[model samples]
Target: MTLILWTALGYLLGSIPFGVAITRVLGLGDLRQIGSGNIGATNVLRTGNKPAAFATLLLDSGKGAIAVLLARHFGGETAAMLAGGAAFLGHCFPVWLGFRGGKGVATFLGTLIALHWPLGLIACGVWLLSAVISRISSLSALLAAALSPVFAWAIGRADLVLVSLFMAVLIFARHRANIARLLDGSEPRIGRGKP
Candidate 1:
């Protein structure tokens, strides 16, 4: 019952849709009508409002981290893991948005950071390096998710491997369309409007 409650709390936090709120509050229009129609930082960047996009990213990631930290504080590592995973699910399939939401990259990284900072930092490094080289947001996210488990294992955090794998799978599942575009070399770059 406690676990269920923590999970619920995590989901609710993750489902806040910071991108939509920030964009709407700033009079940037509806986020859903923008590029890719995603409620993640990358899509928020399409609004041409760097501050709003940055804010959305921080809030989205913060929700996941906060969920994990809160659960850990109240219920130990098990609850923290469950809450973190739930947060990622909420970000990917937010109930408020008819189960359609972001791809879970930011939430994943944030959750990882909360669970283990070193692992999280390594994953972030992977993402940054990939983004710099590829200039593709989806690809960078994919690479980071894909490599998280390996990094966790390398750093002796065997406990994080399974959760990292689970999040990676979900991230891949959510980015199916982006994967298709990437394969065909049609995936859009970071800042442009279209492919």
Candidate 2:
């Protein structure tokens, strides 16, 4: 019962799509119509609203961090990780949004930060470097997710290895369409840069 409650709480928290909500509240219409139809920060940027995009990014990460923190406070250490994972899953497949949700990268990063501050900072660095080099947000997100588990394990967070690795997989999976576009050399680059 407790586990179910944790998962439900986590999912409910994650289902709150900040990008879509913010856009709607601000009379921006359906965010899905503007960009890649994703409710993530990258898509929000496609709207050319830098401030909104930035807010979406921060809020998305905050959702995951808050879930983990709440779990740690009310449940336990393992529960924190579990709730974080549940939040990622929710972001990937939100029930309130027809099971079509944002990619899990932002949420995963937040989860990492909640678990280990240094690892989170390193992951963000890697992500920024990848984005600058490839100019593809998807690629950057993938690389960051891929490296997160390594950093977590290397830092003696063996208990978090499996969870973080699982998170990596989930984030990677959420980028399936981007992966296809990347392979076809048609993926859109980050910001207004070249593809």
Using TM-score as the measure, the top candidate is 1
| TM-score between candidate 1 and the true structure | 0.98
The collision pairs in model 1 are none
**Over 4 Å off in model 1, which ranges?**
none
Clashing pairs in 2: none
lDDT of 2 at 23: 85
lDDT per prediction?
A: 0.93, 0.86
Residue-wise C-alpha lDDT for candidate 2, range 51-167, written one tens digit per residue: 998999999998989998998889888788888888888888888899999998888889889877788888999999999888989999999999888988899888888888998
TM-score of each: 0.98, 0.94
Off by over 4 Å in 2: 193-195
Write down the worst ten-residue block by lDDT for model 1: 186-195
Assess the local accuracy of residue 122 in candidate 2 as a C-alpha lDDT between 0 and 100.
88
